[model samples]
Target: MMLAFILLPLGRMFGQQSPAMLATVAAMPDVQGAITLSLEVAMASAVIAAVFGTPLAYLLARSQFRGRALIEAIVDLPLAVPHTVAGIALLFVFGRNGPIGKIAGQLGISFWGTALGILVGMLFVSIPYMVNSAREGFASVDLRLEKAARTLGASPAQVFWQISLPLALRGILSGVVLTYARAIAEFGAVIVLAYYPETAPVKIYELFLSGGLQQSSAAAVLLLSVTLTTFIFFRYLAYGRAARKGRNQ
Candidate 1:
């Protein structure tokens, strides 16, 4: 059933005048703009998620602090939360009329109707994937290896840089891939928060609502192709590296 649903659209996409469809979306400014914005904002948010998420993941995997469970729950909240609700929550904090928004306005850093808004929306929706992937990665690291390095006159920092980080890198890379994909595909939160600078998903909705299936399918197919291609590339890199390591072992 799942394959049927998936393959049917793919068939239609290929069955159509694919070259013309590609050319049509290629010529549309809104389509190109949305694609560019989605890629740029998604990449930026992925970086942010990776940087902040790594330490949090390490802490979660290694520490046993009070409220640790709560922290984890918070990290996973967005997955269950309606992103439209999340968008509303964000608005109350980042909208020009909102409290944080007022303070940010003083600094001339806008969130509403801008890239920052898209970044926040993407980050909120996608961070759990990064953090969880990294946490699993960090957890899977053999502490004995870190201990061995430490006993070999290596400091904690050295052990982490040389042993733990490298060991967990595959998981982190996987998380980054998931983060990037989620961010690019985000719709409701981004639409609510950063409407003018429409991301690809929102643009697809716009085309669909205004011009119907024919107009929208081209853009949607292009975005899907781009997303799927990038996803496959990353997956190949991550798994191919792992396969090589396994063979070496």
Candidate 2:
């Protein structure tokens, strides 16, 4: 926290020019495009991760199947690998020469340096957060409640929707937020796979390389501000809902 505060002022002092920095910001088409694309891809990636990951998380939570530990470890592989290595692995699967990418290309859907690439990068790095959080949430739910519902002749889907999901939604939401946050801040993988679309982190890196410290720091501050604001708002919303449910209970 102290380091963050220290960096903020130093970043501002070095980068915040009188008016030129503001003008540079306004005139930065690349930066603007990057920011827009980042948001779009991050949101899409988060949604996709949640949809696929939720069922997997549910299974992980409810069952003690063979290789359960292996599955869990596999889910966390992204966290263990270097970000750049993850990008390279994704490229092997999603590059133009890659089998999936080749098929996608025939269908006019490309991944490299496109919005799809951004989503893939975000998904690659951030999916573990959502899956793990949701699994934990589901695990916290009372198995007895589900059993009772089953005994009452509630359909599987009905029991899940009426009992399990409601009980685990907070955890799911927390995971979603963390995934989104991770996606938003992803740099190495995104830069390697989707440099053309240019997420905020890439833009900052470019500015530093091409322009200078002052230019890059300004962009960094802007990115930080946006991320911090969005996180705070979403966190408050999630916590408030949890609190309200607690009160009702």
Candidate 3:
């Protein structure tokens, strides 16, 4: 049932497109541009998520505070929100007359209808993956190791850098991979927020609308291929690192 439900549709989609058709679509400048944009923005979103989410993940994993549960709920809220609704919600903050948007305007930065908007959309929906994964990673680290480091007179910063970060790296990397995948696959929020600068998903949607399934299928296949390839490669690297670390220990 699972195979029929999951693989059948994907298999049909792939089977519909010949290598030549896929090649033709891949060669199209617009297709290439959209895929490139998606990869770039998704990578940026994943990095931003890592930098910003790591502290929060660590805090959530290690701390018990008055509003910690509330914070966790809020962090996970985006996953529950529909992407289109999330986009609409973002527009309130990132729109031209919106608070952040107005302030950003003064700084000559705009989110609406731009790559920044796409990044925002991607980050909004995908950051939970980073935060949650990293939190788990942090939580999985044996506290005794950190305590041992502390006993050895390691500063808090040094303990975190030398002890916690490396142990949590696998989870962080997994989060990054998931975040990138989710960001690249984002369509609803991105289309709502930055339709002009179409990412691969948005471009495929456009092609579907204007040119129908036949025209769009090739591009879809190309995107699926790229996404799957990158996902597999990164997952391999993450797991391979974990294996090496295990052996070293």
Tens digits of lDDT, candidate 2, 58-148: 9999999899999999999999999999889889989999899999999999999998888898999999999999999999999999999
> Compared to the true structure, candidate 2 yields what TM-score?
0.92
lDDT of 1 at 79: 99
lDDT of 1 at 244: 88
lDDT of 3 by residue, 128-217 (tens): 999999999999999999999999999999999999999999999999999999999999899888897889989998899998887799
Q: Please, what is the whole-model Cα lDDT of each candidate in the order they appear?
A: 0.90, 0.86, 0.93
For all predictions, the C-alpha RMSD in Å is 1.6, 2.3, 1.1
Number of residue pairs clashing in candidate 2, backbone atoms closer than 3 angstroms, sequence gap of 3 or more or interchain: 0
After superposing candidate 2 on the true structure, give the runs of residues whose Cα lies further than 4 Å from its correct spot: 1-20
Task: Give Cα distance to truth, residue 247, candidate 1, Å.
Answer: 2.2
Point to the candidate with the largest lDDT.
Answer: 3
lDDT for each residue of candidate 1 in 11-101, tens digit (9 for 90 to 100)? 7875774687679877998899999899989989989999999999999998899999999999999999999988888999999998989
1 or 2: which has the higher lDDT? 1
Evaluated against the true structure, the overall lDDT of model 2 is 0.86
**TM-score for each model:** 0.94, 0.92, 0.97
Once model 3 is optimally superposed onto the true structure by TM-score, how far is the C-alpha of residue 1 displaced, in angstroms?
A: 3.2
Cα TM-score of candidate 3:
0.97
Q: Which ranges of candidate 1 are over 4 A from the true structure?
A: none
